[model samples]
Target: MGAQEDTALVRRGYEAFSAGDMDTLRELFTEDAVWHTGGTGALSGDKKGRDAILAYFGELYSRSNGSLKLTLEDVATGGRYTIGVQSGRADRDGKTLDQRTVIVFTISDDKVIEALEMAEDTAVASEFWS
Candidate 1:
């Protein structure tokens, strides 16, 4: 059940994210799911949760002036595992925000328990993360 549900969750989550559907993505997460990047990478303890995850992105998307888009280039699936290649551009002042990301997700009981993301180009992403 873990692997099956995890596969479904991963596929749908990325599809929703690619469409900027935060509501759908939120539904896939556990109350303590973790989301982070940069110096704040992989938040632990209280920082882990659905509410926290949503709030984190809410603030992040707002900073981008709501011009955030992500597309999954490819996905590899295994028992309780998924890896995806993603490309996205953030525009807020007629300028693009470098956000090429490679995301890894872990799901349990049909809900996401862990979400990890890294910049595909560490250098370019480092410039954008801050």
Candidate 2:
């Protein structure tokens, strides 16, 4: 796919994620897709496969008591790589998390094959999710 098409696909993923549409997410990612989250938090790790990635997303929702909100700021694509910038906020265990994150995605055949997540404030994110 071209850069525009790839960007659109990623935007669709962000929308699907915000809407909690797991079915759409499943369709957007490959069966062997991997998602990487950095930091020392419970949610930080390499989530292998589509099922594991979906479960990580579910954990985000459950941990935040369905209060996690993600706002997509921008998306850019080059070749098969798409980068998405977003801001997220949530409250958990009397701790408030408000952070910006950038996710670099490797797409192939119109589906995401891998995603690497980078939080703007890793220490704060780690504390919040720890």
Candidate 3:
């Protein structure tokens, strides 16, 4: 796919996520996709395969009681990669978490094969999620 198409696909994926469209999100990823959560915290880990990644999403939903929301600021692509700048907010246990995040996606054949997520403040995010 072209760079513009890749960015569009990534944008659509973010839209799906924000809209709680899990089916669309699933369709954007390859069957053997992997997700890397970057941080030195309990929530940091690598989830391999589409099933594992979706299960992680389930865990996040349960932890946040389905109140988490993501807002995308921008998306760009180069070669086979796409980068998304976004912010996420959620309320859990009477505490609110609002953080800026950058996610890098590796795309192949118009599908996301891998994703690596980085947060603006890992320690703060860890505390909030913990």
Candidate 4:
């Protein structure tokens, strides 16, 4: 993929995720795309393939009660690297689930090959994962 295509993929993926558009995200990942949340219970480990990504996003949508939205803090793309910081509250049952994270994505051939997430604090992530 060209530089423009790579940037667009990253932009679209992040935009779709922010809008909770699971359908669009499904088309942006490889069959074995890995999504790691550093052990965050809401998102973690290898969510293999487009199916898994859709399922995980579905879980978020349901659990958040439609309050699950991402507002990107920053985004930078170069070659196969895209770094994005987003903050959102995953709300459910009138309770708010704070999920402020910075995600670094590795893209290949205009598809997301890998995603690594870092919570606002590792200690907080540890507790959430636990």
Q: Is candidate 1 or candidate 3 better by lDDT?
A: 3
RMSD of each: 3.4, 0.8, 1.2, 2.7
> Could you give the candidate ranking by TM-score, starting with the highest?
2, 3, 4, 1
- The C-alpha TM-scores of every prediction are 0.76, 0.97, 0.93, 0.79
lDDT winner between candidates 2 and 4:
2
lDDT of candidate 2 over 25-95, digit per residue (tens): 99999999999999988789899999999999999999999999999999989875899999999999998
**Leading candidate by TM-score:** 2
Give the per-residue lDDT digits (tens) of candidate 3, residues 1-130.
Answer: 8999899999998888778788998999999999998776677889999888888787777889999898999998887579999999989999988989999999999899999999898887777766
Candidate 1 ranges with C-alpha deviation above 4 Å = 2-5, 18-20, 38-47, 93-95
Q: Which structure among the candidates has the greatest lDDT?
A: 2
Task: Give the better candidate number (1 or 3) by TM-score.
Answer: 3
Candidates ranked by lDDT, best first? 2, 3, 4, 1
| Superposed Cα deviation of residue 61, candidate 4 (Å) | 1.2
Residue-wise lDDT of candidate 4 within 16-84, one digit each (tens)?
Answer: 877767778888998898877666454556676767767877766776566677777767777667887
Q: List the residue pairs that clash in candidate 3.
A: none
TM-score of 1: 0.76
Regions of model 2 farther than 4 Å from truth: none
